[model samples]
Structures are given as structure tokens and as C-alpha cells.
Target: MTNYVGSCLCGAVTFEIEAEFESFYLCHCKHCQKDTGSAFAANLFSQTGKLIWCSGEDNISSFTLAGSQHQKSFCKDCGTALPNNHSSGILVVPAGCLDTDVAVIPTAHIFMSSKASWESNVVNIRKLEGLPE
Candidate 1:
């Protein structure tokens, strides 16, 4: 069994999750894009019982889109996404905040019909380890 650690950008919130993640999804839904302020959201799914908050649990905040099941949790101090527990017994973890390696790669891109026009053809852009010169 493996364990993964994660933290908010300001380190104000930290957590651990048992390495029971089963699937990875790159969601392109409008809610995901807006919540992440990016092209998509990388989410790891597991049972809700797998998550354990190591510290600063009080700093976490959650939001839900009106009239939808779309929900997100984050650190109120640094605005880094945290895990969310769904009533369906599922846990959604933001891949960006995870400090450990994701052994399982994302199997597919989902909700592409809602993807932004600027999100495609990314193979043409210059990649970088940090910032550009």
C-alpha cells in the first residue's frame, strides 16, 4: 500500500491520502476550467475514506455551482485546490496539489465538447521546466 501527501500553495493546509486512486480524469467542463482558472482540471478519484487531513483542516473551503453537482474545495489562504467528498461516496483530489508521483496516468480527456478553443494544438507551444527566457 502506498500513501500520497499534498499541501496547499501556502502550506497552510496539508493532507494525506491512501494510494487507492483508481482513475484520473482531465475534465474540460466549464465549471472545472473556471474553478482551476485554466484549461482543465486533473482529478483523481477514490473512496472518501482514503483522505486524511494532516493539518490546517480549518483553512479549507468548498464551493458548489448552483443547480449542479460540480463542486470544488480549496485552501482559503492560498487558494490551492483540496480534495472534495461527494455524497456518492467518492473523493475527488486535485492532481496539482499532490506532492507525490501519480503512478497512473490520465486515461482520457473528458467533456471535450466544453473545452476552450485555445486549449487545443498544445504540442506546438514551447515547453519549459520553469519560466521562459
Candidate 2:
């Protein structure tokens, strides 16, 4: 297993995760788009308990969206989104926050049905209307 480090945009919050590099995904769900204010969200998933908050734990803010099981975490200073625990106990880390070079390529597009029509197709990746099969 490799150790990875990450921090929020304002450097207020930092964390480390001991995990194996794995494939990522681009989610186009409406909630993701609104939460990120982007066409989609890039996410890296890893097992729970491997993630450790190295600094600024008090600066991390969390919000539990209505009707959703996931709680979103962000830097209280800069509002930069950070990793959060999923109901399944996995850590869903935003790809852009990682400090190490990521080796995994995105394997599939989730919630593609909600993806913007203007977005170009990802070459060679499996495109699914919802989650990967």
C-alpha cells in the first residue's frame, strides 16, 4: 500500500491516507454538479480507516445534504472541498486535492445520463448511464 497526502485549497486542512491506488470516476449526478459547481466531479475511492487527518481537523466543515447519506467536507477558510466518508465506509477523495501523482485513470463515467451534452466523450472509457456495471 502507498501513502498519499492531501490538503485543502487554503492549506488549512491536511490529511493522509494509506491505500492502494485505484481507478477513479467522473460523476455527473445533479448533486455532484451542484456541489462542485462543475459539469462533473472527479473522485478517488479507497477503503475506510486508512485515512488520517494530519492537520487542521478543526478547520474542516461538514454538511449533510437533505435526502443524502453522504456528508460533504470542505475547508472552512477557502471552501475547498475535501474527502468524506461514504455510507459504505469508503473515503471519497476529490481527485484535485491529492498531493501525490495519481496512477489510476478514470474507469467509467457515472450518471452519464445527467452529463452535459456539450461535454466531449471520454475516449476508451466505459460510459454508463448510472453506476458502472
Best by TM-score: 1
Global CA lDDT of candidate 2, please? 0.83
Indicate which candidate wins on lDDT: 1
lDDT of 1 by residue, 2-113 (tens): 7899999999999988857778999999998899899999999886348899999999988988899998899999999999887577989899999998898997899999
Give the per-residue lDDT digits (tens) of candidate 2, residues 1-133.
8888999888989999888646588899888888898888899887743889999999988888888765678998998888888777788888898898888899788998998765665565777899765
lDDT of the candidates, in the order given: 0.88, 0.83
Per-model TM values vs. the true structure:
0.94, 0.83
Candidate 1 lDDT: 0.88
The Cα RMSD in angstroms, rounded to one decimal, for candidate 1 relative to the true structure is 1.3
The CA lDDT at 106 in model 2 is 91
